[model samples]
Target chain A: MSAAGRTVRPVSIASFAQSQNVRKDNERNEAEGLQPVIAEVFANVGITKDDVDFICSGSTDYLIGGPFSFVMALDAVGVWPPRAESHVEMDGAWALYEAWVLFQEGEIDAALVYAFGRSSLGDLNEILTLQLDPYYEAPLWPDIVSLNALQARAMIDAGKATEADFAAIASRSRRDALSNPKAQVRHDVAPDVLLEDDYVVAPLRRHALPPITDGAAAIVLAAGDKALQWSERPVWITGFDHRMETHSLGARDLTVSPSTAKAAEVAGVADGNVDIAEIHAPFAHQELIIAEALGLDDSVAVNPSGGPLAANPLMSAGLIRIGEAASRIRAGQADRAVAHATSGPCLQQNLVCVLEGA
Target chain B: MAERCAVIGVGQTHHKAKREDVSIAGLVREAAKMALADADLTWSDIDAVVIGKAPDMFEGNMMPEIYLAPALGAVGKPMFRVHTAGSVGGSTAIVAAHLISSGIHKRVLTVAYEKQSDSDAMWALSVPQPFAAPLLAGAGGYFAPHIRAYMRRSGAPDHIGRMVAVKDRKNAMRNPYAHLHLADIDMKMVEESMMLWDPLRYLEACPSSDGAAAMVLAAEDAVSGHYPPAWVHGMAMRSEPTMFAGRDQINPQAGRDCSADVYAQAGVTDPRAQFDCAEVYVPFSWYEPMWLENLGFCGQGDGWKLTEAGATAFDGDIPWNASGGVLSSNPIGASGMLRFLEVAMQVRGQAGEHQVDGAKLALGQAYGGGSQFFSMWVVGSAKP
Candidate 1:
C-alpha cells in the first residue's frame, strides 16, 4: 500500500523532433511553426496523430501577448474527434511529465508531447519578470540578467564558483554546439579568450547568456509493448521526479540546488553509471550548481547538444534536453543518461528524469 | 486503472466580486489550508501539489504556481501548473488524481483560482493580436450567438434561460460560499434586466468574481478516517480544434465525448438516473440546457424540455447545481474546480442546507476554450 513500494509502469521514448533553433522567424505563426515538427516526430515512428491516445503541450501566454495561446497550438497536432489533452505553462518537459502520468494510468497506451515558444516576439527579459512574485518582485521589473547575476555573485561569495568557472562552462558548451546544426549559437572560443569578453552583467560575460530563441519540439511516449514496436532502441524512463524550493531568493542558500538534489534522489539519478547528461541550465554558473546537485562526475559528458546555453527557447529548451539525451541512447551513443529541467528564478523548481537504453 | 484514488477533502473560499483582503498567494493558501484541515492531514503529509488557472493575464502574474509553491507547502515536493483555459480547475484536480491513481504519489493537493479584480479580464481577453480578430464580445459576446443557435436548433422557449437563472440564483441563497444571493430574484426581474448580449440578460451571465477552490486527493490506503471519502469513480478530459467546418458550437462534441468516457467508466447507463445530483458548469443561463444535452442526460434538442418541465431544479428528479454553480460564483479559473468540489461534497453528505437528500452519486463538469476543452468526473459515496 505504500507509495514508495509501488512500481511505475515502464514507459519509453520512441521518437523525437525539433525545429531549427533561431533568433526569430516572422513567416510562421505558433501553430505553423509546430506542424512540421509534430508531423515528423510521428512519421519518424511510423505512426500518426491517431496513434496517440493523449496530447499535451507547453507554452506561456505572455510570450504571445494573449491568453489561451496554447489553444491555437493544438491545431498543429490535428486533434479531431475529441482527444484527451492538457497543457502546462512552464516548459515542454512538464508537458511530457503530464503525458507520462497519463500513460502510467494504464488506460492510455501512447501520448504525444510538444512545446513551442517565440521569445523573439516580445521583450524576453521584461516578460520573464512577470513570472516573479507579483506583489513583491514583479513590480520591481528586475530583468532576468540582473537576477541571475545576483545568483552568480552569491555563488562566488560562497566560494562555490567564480567568473572563470562560468566562462569555462560556456566555452565548452558553445564549442560542443558547433557539432549541433539545430543550435542557434556555436563557436570555438577558449575559456581564457571567452573570459576576455565584456560582461553582460558584473560577473557574467556575453558567453554566459543564452541566445533568445524561437523554436518548437515534439516527442512520442509509448508504454511497454508499444515502445518496442515504435523503435529499435527505446530509451526507457527508469525514474522521474520533480521538486520545488521556496520562491523567495533570500529564503534559499543560493549556492546549491536542494530541489534538484531532492529530485535526483527521488528519480534515482545515481542508481548506475551515467554516460551522458543533458542539464537545462540557461545561465553559465547555474550549470555548475545543477551538476553538483545531480552528483555527476567528469566521466559524464554534459550538454553534448550544447545544452540551453547553445539554444535557449523559453519553453522548448527544457524538453530539448530530454530529446537530446534520448536521441543519443537511440543512436547507440550512450547507454544511460539523466535529463534535468528547471523553472523559476535560480532553479527554484527542478525535474529529473533517469533514462536507460534497455 | 493503475491504482485507486479518492477525494478526501474539499474546500472553497467565499466567492465574491473582489477579495482585496488577501494577496494572491494568501487567497489560494486559505483554501489549501482548509482542505488540509478537512482531510486531517498537514502540509508535510502531502506528496505533491498541482495548481491551475485560466491564464496569467487574469491576475497579471505569469506562472503563478512557481511563486505559489511555497505557500502551498510544496518545498522539496513536485508541483505542477495546469492551464487549459476555463476548464483549468477541473483539469488541475484530474492531474493530481492521476498522480495518485498512477501510484506515483499518496496524498496530493490540488488548487485553482482567479483574482479577476487584480486585473481586467475583459482587457486580457480582448487584447489586440497582430493578424487575428479579437474576441471583441468577450466571453458572453462570443457565446451569445451560440446560445441563439441552440435556441434556433431546438425551438426552446425564451423562458427556459430565465427559469435556469431563477433556480440557480435562488439555490445560491442556501450556500454561503456562492458569490451571488438574489433575495428578490424572479423571472420578471431576470427578463427585465439589462441585455449585454442578445438573448443573454445581465442576470443570465456569470459574474466576474475572485476566489479559489482546493481539494486533497488521496490514494486508497491514505484515505482519512475522520470523514467519509468520495471515491473517484472516473474522470476524463477532451479537446478539439477551436474552429473547424463541421464543429457544432451549441453542443460541443468534445464535451459529449468527455462525459461519455467518464460515464462509461463509472458504469452509468443513463446519467439522469445514475447521478443523484449534478454540478454542471453553467456560466450562462442557456448553458444549463445546452450542457444537459451535451452530458447525455437527455437527447440533443430535448435538453430544454427537462428545464421547461422543472426536472433540473433542486426538488426535481435529477437535481442540477443544487449549490448554485458557475452562474452564481464565476471565478474564471476556480469555477471548474468548484463544480468538482461540490460533487465531492454532495457524495460525501457534507453539503449543508443546499444538499440533496440521500445524494450518493454526482457528476461534475467543466468546459473552456470556446467550448473545445472539457473536463468531467463522477464521484460516488461507495467505492468503485
Candidate 2:
C-alpha cells in the first residue's frame, strides 16, 4: 500500500489455448508447435496480433539446447516490421506477470503472452541439475527428483506430511484429470491402491512424480474497454506477485516454502474467499505444502484441471494454471480463484495470481 | 506523460576470460553491492530487482534469476527476469527504469550477468535443431556473412574493420575494468591473429568473459540522495523475428526503428551533432561503423567513412566506446548493460580514467539475436 488512492485497473484473461502435451514432439519444430496454439487463442478472442500493443513470451534455451530459442519462436507470430516485444527465460506465468505490469503502465491496452517447452530432447532430471550452484551443488550432480525427495523426506520426518497423504493427492489428481482432455496422465485410481506403488525416492512414490511433458500455451490480456469488448465475462487479475528464495537447499527450510507464502501474502490471497486454487506443484507432496502455505481451506476446490501432476509442461505449466483458473471464472463456476506457479528446485521461486469474475 | 526517471548509480566488474575467483552469485553481487554503495543506499532501499542475460545455457542454468534473487537481495520482493539475446542487458535496464517511470517503484536495482566460463558458449550456440541448416560454427560464423554483405553494400575498404579493432583495444587500455588490456595491440597484431570466421579475425571479435553490470534507477523524487544523476531522456525497444522472407539481417530495420523512436523522444534532430558521446554494442569491430549508421549518427552507407575519418576515435568529435565497449569484454548478458552504464558514467562524470571531457548528452544502444532485437536509450546530464 505505498499509494492508498492508486486505482487498480482490472486486467483480464480474454482467451487461452494450449498444445497437446506429448513426451516427444519430433514432427513439429518449436515455431510449428506453437503456431496453432497462438492462432487458436487469437481466433477465440476475435483479435489479431495487430490489435495487441505488447507481445511477451516465456521460454528457456536449455530446453532447446541453444541460445535465442524464444527469438526464433517469434516466427510463429510473424513479426514482420518488428513490434514491442520482450522475453523471459522463465515460466510463461512470469511472462504474464511482466505483461500485467506493462498493463499497469496504462500506455498499452492489450498484450499477448505465451510460453513453450520441449522436454523430449534430453533427460529432464539430468538437465535440471544445472540450476543448482555450479561450484557446489551442481558438482554433486543431484537430479531434480532426488532433491524433491529430500524435501518430501524432510517434511515426512518433521511430521508435516505422510506417505499416505502423498498417495491421496495423486489419487485425487488422477481422478480430476479424467475430465481434462489435455492431461497427459489421466486415470482414476484408489488411494489405497496408489499406496502400493514403488518408491522412486524414499517417501516419494512413482505416482507422486510428474511425467515429462512437452507443450505450449498462450493467453491474451486486455484492459479497460478492450477487455469488455473481447469477452462476455472477463477473469480479472485482482492481485499478483512473485518471490524467490535462496539457491542453496541447505540454506532454506526444506519443510516450508517461504517464497510461496510470501508471494501468496503479497498477492492478497487472504483478502477474499477463493473458490478454486490451481497450484503448480509438480510433485504430489509439494501440493500439500503449497496448499498449506497459501492457507487454503478444504472447501476450496484445488486442481480441478488436474494441475501439474497430470500435464506438467515445464515452462508453460504455470501459465496454464492461470488460464485454467481464469476459465473457471469466465464460465461462472467460481467467483474467485488463485493460480500459483513455481520455479527452481523445491519451489525456490513462486508466483501467485488472484483472479475474480467480473 | 510518464514519471521522470534517472540513473542514480552504476557498477560493473572487471571483465575477464575467467572470473574463477567468485561464483555466479558472487559475481553479480559484486556489481550490485557497488551500485548500492554508489547510490548511498542498502539492499532494503530497493523495491524490486530485474535481471537479464543472453541465454541460460551460457551459464548452464535455466531461469537463473530464481536462484539469484536472494543473493541480489530480492527475496520477499517482486522480481522479474528478461532475456532477449544480447540485447537482454539493455532491455533489463530499460525494464527496471520503466518500473519507476510507470510510477510503480521509487527505486529499482537492475542487474545482468553471464558466466561464460561455466559453460562453452560456442557449444550453446551450435545446438543442432531440426529443419535448420547445420550452422555448427559459433556466433562469429553466423554473423560473418552479414559483415561481408555490409562491406559489399557500403563498399568500405577491408582496412576499416582492422582500424576499429585497433581503436577499441587501445581504448580498453584506458579502462581498468576492461577485460582485454592489449597494451601493445595494433594493426600488425590484429592482421596476424587467427581467422575464425571468414572476413572476421580473432582480434576483430569480442572476447568471452565472466562479468556483471548493475544500475540503480530512481524516480525524480528519489534522486535527492545521489549527486549528478544521469537523467533518462528517452528509451525504446523493438524486436522482429530472427528470420523472414525478406528481412535484412545485415542492417536490421528493428535497430533503425528503435534508434529513430528514441531520438524522437529525446528531441535529437541530428544524432551526430546533438549527442556528446555514444556507447554501441560492437561484439565484432566492424559493427561500430555499421551501428553508427543504423543509429542515425550518420547517413546510411556513410558509416564506415566515419571510422576511416577517425571520427569515432576516443578523442574524436563523437567519441564511441570510450569505456572500451563490448569489443573488449563481452559477458553476453551484461555486455549490453555495460554500454548503457558506460553512457551514464560519461554523463555523470564517474568514469575515472575513461571519462570523456565535458560530456553532456550521451546515447546507449544494444542489439541482439540475428540483429533482429534492439534496445536503446538516451541520457543526459540535465533532467529532461
Best-performing candidate as measured by lDDT: 1
* Position A249, candidate 2: lDDT: 86
Model 1 lDDT per residue over A1-358, tens place = 1125666677888999999999997999999999999999999989989998899999999999898889988989877888999999989999999998877778788999999999999897898898899989889999999899999999999999989999999999999999999999999999999989998888888989989999999999998788999988888888888889999988898889999998888788887899999999999999999999999999999999999999999898989999999999999999999999999988888999988997
Q: In candidate 1 chain B, what residue range of length 10 has the lowest lDDT sum?
A: B128-137
- Strongest candidate by TM-score: 1
List iRMS (one decimal) for every candidate.
0.9, 1.6
Report the TM-score of candidate 1, chain B only.
Answer: 0.99
How do the residues B1-384 of candidate 2 rate in per-residue lDDT, one tens digit apiece?
278899998888988999999989999999999999889989999989999998788878777886787789998777889999889999999889888887778999999999999889898888787677766888899889999999999999998999999999888888999999999998989999999898999999999999999999999999844559999999888998866868888778888889888988899989989999999999998898899888888888999999999899988999999888898999999999999999999999888888889999999999888888999999999988
Which residue pairs collide in model 2, if any? none
User: Relative to the unseen true structure, what is the C-alpha lDDT of residue A148 in candidate 1, on a scale of 0 to 100?
Assistant: 93
TM-score of model 2's chain A, to 2 decimals?
0.98
Model 2 regions lying over 4 Å from their true place: A1-6, B224-226
User: Per-residue alpha-carbon lDDT of model 2 for A1-358, expressed as tens digits?
Assistant: 2122344567999999999887778898889999999999999988999999888999888888777788779999988778988998889999998888777777688999999999887888888988887667777989999999999999899999999999989899989989889888999999999999999988789999998899999999999999999999988998887887777788888888878888788778888898999999999989988998999999999999999999999899999999999998898899999999998899888999899998
Clashes of each: 0, 0
What DockQ does every candidate get?
A: 0.87, 0.65
